[model samples]
Target: MKGQIMDKKIIVLLSGCILAVFLLAGCGNDEVSSEYNIEYLNKDKTKIVDVPYEPEASDTDGMIKEFLAKLSSDSDNVEYRKPIPNGVEVTDYSLDGVMLSIHFDADYSSMTEVEEVLCRAAVVLTMTQIPGVDCVSFYVADAPLTDIRGNIVGSMNQDSFIENPGEQINSIQCTTLKLYFANETGDGLVEETRSDVYYSSNVSMEKLIMEQLLEGPQTEGAKSAIPAGTKLINVSVVDGVCYVSLDENFKNQDYQVNEAVVIYSIVDSLTELSTISKVQISVNGDTSGTYRDNFKLSDMYDRNLDYVVSLEETGVTEEE
Candidate 1:
């Protein structure tokens, strides 16, 4: 009887150990199945689609390599397209802190403007999913990548390519803008209220404002002081200062408008946002010299309402 009892106890102990081992194995499998989405351009190459992916690698370095390889390879699904174009190979990459710098061959420069932006958006969205990476910068032929306007395409993160929650790219949203434009005489600024301005959510408010300024004013008696054909290179706000970079076309001036009118139109329009207290304008990222002859590009400008004309002064009435 004693021997039988001992045998029964031993059997129970073995069974418990086996059960524990199986539980641990199940946990390991769960960890392996942890999901992350890999972003890819759709068949049309106009939009990005996020596909569920389970990376085999457990470490950050391994995950980076794995994701990059996946980005460069053809997607198994025919509807999805590879982010990296053919003949454009990644030469090298390095990680410093949270920023990842990727260098590509000369062929990367051959991609069209739209293709390049989409590729960049896809890569940024994919890599930023990793635990350690927070931002990405691209290099072509050992030089930093530049936008079509020739301004440096600096580091980008998930926020750089924004998408509405539960919506795809180019999601439209509406807002009101209190834009300042040149008056009829072209020597003073006039406030124009634009309501229901629909724009893509992917575009930042600063960029949207600049675009509208370039598009000119819709209200009567208001004219756009900004030169036509000017392209916005980049717009960023840091520490209460909004930096506006434009293409070479910005240097072309309409002599009829006062320099301050042109300058304050931008400053006042941007400073309307609570985040910005000052504005700094640059041309192709170059801040040296002056805009036309008086307004210095290097100087930070505060909102000057002195140039803004009242509605009555412009022979316009405010709608009650």
Candidate 2:
């Protein structure tokens, strides 16, 4: 009986030691994990945007794992098409200057086309947010990973995903655009010269500039005359006349700005492009849609810089 009691006591003591070790390890791991911001596609999948997340580990692999785990879990606001598969794992990672190379388990080799793109977009956008990381490449079983189009070409940055926006990769070429935005008082428009990236391959430069106008200005003292949630449906040019189609969001307004300011904002901005001489606005595909300001949507407008207010005089801009 004495021997049996001693053995039982020894077994209990060993189990207690193991449990303590596990608790300590878990505590240490928690301390090593940290929080940071990462960009993910919005729920509508319309834009590559940023949000905050607490990761499981502070190291590169750990941060990635936590990001992938959150992507699969849908605990955040963003949309992710393929969750990290059950058997897939990040085996190793290396950061050499701006490039990040991540090796995964064999399961990574079997992702579907859509899954591959979404997964790659998620990884690249999230990892590149790291201070020194600019590009990302993947590997499976020591082999270069395949992309959405099944190309084995290596290395991808923000521009690699430009053909698909909200994937948020910008392969942008810088160009100057003379865009008009609301001055500080919202009473008049202001001319702001913006050096922005050229992002569209399917549309004309004039149309892209109009879309940027709808995206609003990046300048501090400027405000967008376009209504919030407004989307550019289509833009076409014929004989120097640019026809712009916007969604129904354009018809509605919550804030009071001079109606002429809004109209001339579009006109002056697009006419700055050499290909465009005039602009005709449309709402929800209807050329006849007119606002209360008596400006007919059907009218072809020429540039009217008369309404542009000098930023030096107003000394005011919209508050973010």
Candidate 3:
């Protein structure tokens, strides 16, 4: 009986130990699999762009906090620069429906107009990329944001930043075109200005932008997003959407950049034209499909400036 009692006690202890191990394993597996692609401003501060990062926390709030930490200017990644001014920090954040409210310390009130707009743009672009989050609202110590128009913005979406037209000059000899190209790593897009691109009465600004993009980047560290020999078949604008049709060679090219890089490179470059708000791509007249099965081309894509990589994120300071 004594030996039987000892054996029973051993079995009970082993059972408890097994249960504890299983519980620990379950906890270890709880981390979320989703990665957040956060946006930051480029080196010249002309464009905002994104870089991918995996948040360490499993909960929504924790994931956002982890993202804010990366955006705090203390992160190790060279490509994760923060638009939020130095000494500014996200005190807290919350989500309701499609809106996210971020509360900052009092220091946030000190940012200049451009600084505040860019900072808010970065946060909204970064957070909205996450599933189920569409809009963002800013707060400082529970006070809401008031626009220059005197109306409090309930929330701001991507549409809040519309492309305002710059001064346009029409001359008989030549015209300038603005184009966006992929960075060397193919992780971001860089804006390149083609000031003296020769164009006649037959050449449209839309055509010139695509032609310049296909010609590839002039800057050393920038790269061409379009594949070689990809000819632009036609471009037209109906309503607010720009229809871009390319040749069959556009589909089977050997460009190694991310699909987002390739798609946005074209979409973003053309959308720089204030006349276009969205773009639809077609390969060999087939608008019902996608490019390389990566993304559906049938759907119209707005200029995803968020996919452009920030030059600030690409450089490491000497102190690091």
Model 1 RMSD in Å is 16.2
RMSD of 3: 22.1
TM-score of each candidate structure, all chains considered together: 0.51, 0.48, 0.44
User: On residues 1-320, what C-alpha lDDT tens digit does candidate 1 reach at each position?
Assistant: 12221121100001111121110112123444334766776666655665667889978889889999999987887777898989999999999999999999999999865567668877887887788888999999999998654679899977665454333234334578999999978878999888866554567788888878987888777889888788889999999999999999988888888888989999999999889999999999999999887889999999889999976797876564
Q: Tell me, what's the RMSD of every candidate?
A: 16.2, 21.4, 22.1
* TM-score of decoy 3: 0.44
Ranking by lDDT: 1, 3, 2
- Quantify all predictions' global Cα lDDT against the true fold: 0.77, 0.63, 0.65
Of 1 and 2, the candidate ranking higher by lDDT: 1
State the weakest 10-residue window (summed lDDT) of model 2.
9-18
- Give lDDT tens digits, candidate 3, residues 1-320: 12221121100001111121110111122453324555555453433544545666766667676667666663344433477869787888888886888889989878855566667766765666555567789888788877543447578765444222121211123455677887777777876676655432235678778877877877656788887778889988889798999998787655567778889999998898899999999997679877776879898999888876555564522121
Task: Score candidate 3 by lDDT.
Answer: 0.65
Q: If both were scored by TM-score, which would come out higher, candidate 1 or candidate 2?
A: 1
Worst window of 10 by summed lDDT in candidate 3:
9-18
- Model 2, position 74, has a per-residue lDDT of 47
Best prediction by TM-score: 1
